[model samples]
Target: MELLAGARIALTPRPVERRHAALEVAMLGHCPGRVRLERLLQLPAALADMRAVGYGQAVDAFSSGAASELYNLPIPLQSSAEFHDIFPDALTATTEYVSLLAGNKAWLGLAVDDFFANGGEKLWVVRIPESAGQAGFLPADATQLHDITTLQGLACVLVIPALGVVGFPDLERLQIPPRLPDIPRVRLENFEPQFLPCTQNTEDDHRERRYSSELSDMPPPWQLPQVLRGMLQYVSSHRPDLQCLFTLPLAYSGELDSPVLDPTALSALSGYQQLPDRAQALRHVQFLFPYLRGPRFALHTPVGLIAGQQAAVARRDGPWRSMAAKPLNTDALPYPRLSIAQTLGLRDKPGISVLNYRNSFSGGAQLSLDDERLVVPALPVADYPVDRQRYDGFCSAEVMRFLGFLRRQLQALGEQLIFNLDYRDPRPRLLLEQFFRRLYSQGALRGASAEQAFSIRESTPQEGAMLYEIMLAPAFPIDRLFLTFANLNGEWRSEVVDG
Candidate 1:
């Protein structure tokens, strides 16, 4: 948005700044009639982040009516204690509101995501144990909580509890450390807004070493195939443009000692060398083609794996000794693989055009002592994995809107540039091609040759209506790095390869 704002300022006249203008932001708190009330909780932090980046005067879709009652205090409520004292009713009101929503099945996953995304200190969700009924309530079961995040198709939920939820007393006992509820230090695993770099694994200083909890949990045995199948189908349905997607195991929590199901056990159960490929896997999604002998890195890590890493490479020992040195094949993985570390690093790199789940704070971070969520001094923001796609797709859509405006203006003047009045005229098609060529000349698309950068093909499927297919190789971010090794004498020199 900041970049777009700058662009808007540069394109408009200097006098335009003097005139009053407003930018309205509208967002959904919940999908109407959906069995989910917690969908909009993550929205708060997202809005906060946007505001910090110069997006202001935006109205909240859910709570705009309450705006008149709210005030921006000169001395901001610095702590929860301050918030409690200033507005005693607010805490209880919020607690009751959360409790009511927490009873629903969707709340278990949505609430955790909301709390983490919003950087809240702690979130407690109470469930009535079946053995005790309504009178004797307890924190939700550990296994149940884990399943809520993993098996229940909520792998996107990041803050999975390391231990079961504990009991909490009334407001009077809240401040006392001993009497307060013992909410477990939930693992900020699986797609954290920030990550530690995997490159410096040898660094002894834990404080200096970086790590990425991008894929924290490993889903249950039966869940892996389902996730892969669904995403693969989605990509396949939207081919060419959506040919490939960056993926991590959405099965289990990385916080768990043993998050994923054993591949050997899976193979034994199925009596096959690899997990059975779904119907979608039988087809390809363009780009590279490789017959995967195993799914080693794909199941266990967030690393990119290619055909070169397959075990079959090791079998053919003629001249290609490097291939022979590779590890034994495990199972066939159908996707273009990269580790979470690599994926995060490429969030802003150029040239690459793959879709990934990475964010601004993937480099390194400090956990807020108050909230236990990632805190980057530069950009204190938290977002879900899908936000990467949303942000990228949004910018592209805005550019398209601008181009559409230009096209509309041309049509109003009866210029046969974007839309040809007569389908038989070759001048409109030539003009359209020249328009895109100008964009390429001005360095709009990502490529060396104009042909590689953009292309326009006219289609007339109907008698009167004309369709134009504008192809562009959108740029991708190189937010990750991989090691490159060169044997210098007896010592191997390592170099970094940007994605």
Candidate 2:
């Protein structure tokens, strides 16, 4: 008889591992022409000189690299202090070329500074090339919109498995002029002439130069809703683990007091109708309002500040902690200040979050996040109730982040065991259960006991894949509080009431 062939064993080595930090953020925007001078210098001598001179002279020169490129900036090492040294095109008081081409105001630079100042540790900057035209600000044409909706515009960011949040600072810049307001003329009619140390050949004289006014016109307000919808959908479908933090475009004529009433307002509560109906898409998007003004910078969107806060909160506590009602550690103040009634109105809106001032015990007013809300739809009535088992967990940003964290952790575990484990192996299941128990011990899950906190079970396998169903009871933040005050027996007393 022929000898039986020994069983063949094909060993599959595990793939290379990549680690991701929690709550990392990616910012996509336009950079000044000085940022690309290094790459231009690598060209032929004649071509390099021509492009450099031409770029300096042009207002909308193509300085950014391909849309797929990402510039990683680690905290402290490559912080704002080293920003100019790293990217020569960065806006500096002495960089005349940047002032001429970019109006001496780079939103990207300000955003980067705000991010680092607010406790952000890791950042990825995606520069939108000038070739994108209006799309570099907000998608204007069909081709531009296609790039965003298809996820090609943010391909570099999306490829990073660890990216937790993303924002488009330049997107809101489309609502305002690129240049800052001109210095107001002062009247010296009533002032008495005084001798001062003045020299006709002062060094400051060489710094004064007229900036270009050929900046691009502000895009129409209607384009905002369309662009936002595309972004929401892109993040939802391609990377559900990520959150898109956005700043609503400012009102065209007046203050953003009543965002729900204006259909043109991108942050309008009613504007959700223009977005995709999928709950997944809506939950992945968040909007902040009114912009902010600080001593170091002019009026700018609060996306950078909020993104930094999210990272800081996630690192200090857990991603499940709510960022609302917490004092921001920045000196920036909200612009077009809203009255108490207006602030309450904004707080009541289900989609938008507002930044407002609160009186602290130290006798000073502090800027704080009023609420943390997602772009989810309103709950349905009991009669025509849809399955909300999944939807309910995503209504809060805190819950959404917790779920994303679990997804990342589970994904990493699976990757590590892909080639080493068998479908029938019990070790993987034990590891998963232990992993959840560890989370429960860490206060991520809420329950009187382990059984109530979470439940894990193997699901029916499909094809060649093993599956598991994990039901989790994540701890939620206290969003509302009730007080009972009554006058009893000639005494006034107040007690906490349960909802």
Candidate 3:
């Protein structure tokens, strides 16, 4: 009876839980604010009921001239189909009359609609002022730079750790004012036109009948570059996890003429010779070019579409996947229809992503991203040795995004364990190992094995601080492929050749 002792057994450890990363975008622009009570009272009963009783705070917080606010897409407002139903009068309100008007000419509404249509899920909106005096495109002085409305919106983003992308759909509008035609007066059938005569007026009577026009000063050529440089510096210094998306201002000779792709204009916008730390600052920004023409709107910027595509890819695949060569989801066409040579010219240039049509395998022409390139300094820093700097990883958008994701995950881990775990604890090292192993298994790291994919080591500790150095081989997308076709021994043969 003593021989029948119970056996002891050990159970298997549970798998480590992975965090779900849902990419979110922050959009700052001039959007319609809360409809006034009087305006609401005048709406149709069905449309009026769309605004729920409990959402007053959110509505007021996002009202015209209000600070930045967060909103979950296709909710509260239900869906894109109900945008007008939820806020009925935003479409018709003009800049001069309404407190907050929908920026139709500026393309704010169109950008929002396009974002959701292209698979964006979460959004943070900042409703800035409409007039030039209240909110200039770029702040005039150092004091005003910190107080810029866009910077205020970015401040809101900093509080939310999950927001990864920031864009200003109306940012280009500040520099390029819309050119409107002059209004003509109609002649009366039976009565002579009467005009008021005053000592102040020196023009003819008919001329006095014309309405006063709004004048917009032409912004300086350096205005946009300076603004972009400031934004990039801010993002690089404060939040390395976030990416700023911008559309290069369209180049045109006259207000009435269509936009053209001017090399000199692009050079002015991207040239960073004046900055001491151009490489560091440029890595945080991605510039898109050549405005698009869609069925819903005549003309629109590419930033909204790029942001949506980035989110969609991050959700479906990993953030490390390249967005290049992906077909655009909207029914838009690249305006000014670039030729093959023109497309190649844009592709050769760095720091810009161009939209162009590519022939698919099925022999159909489909619009797709030619390449996804990050903005990087054309020249190496003078202070550093040429061999010491690695620009290849920074040049690839996918690689930079992967690095950002890695930084965010590591920061979160450190924050969670800072108080409880000791610096020398073996558990922390084991957790990091497990995390990298998971990433490697998911095909995010490029290597034959986990050891080759990544390495983590605790560096020499200083007073009250522990530092860890991590080196990872991030996965990269194929940028080029070569094929050769030849006839050998009266038989045609084709094979892929590596470069």
Query: Against the correct fold, how does model 1 do in TM-score?
Result: 0.27
Candidate rank order under lDDT = 2, 3, 1
lDDT of 2: 0.59
- Given candidate 1, what's the lDDT at residue 385? 38
For model 3, residues 234-281, the per-residue Cα lDDT tens digits are 567667877787766545445435456645656764466334566556
* Cα lDDT, all candidates: 0.27, 0.59, 0.58
TM-score of each: 0.27, 0.72, 0.71
Off by over 4 Å in 2: 1-20, 36-78, 93-104, 137-152, 177-222, 254-263, 266-279, 377-394, 462-464, 490-493
Query: lDDT tens string, model 2, 48-82?
Result: 32233222222123333333232221111124444
Q: Alpha carbon lDDT of residue 31, candidate 1?
A: 11
Question: Candidate 2 versus the native: TM-score?
Answer: 0.72
Best by lDDT: 2
Residue 318 Cα positional deviation in candidate 1, in Å, after optimal superposition: 46
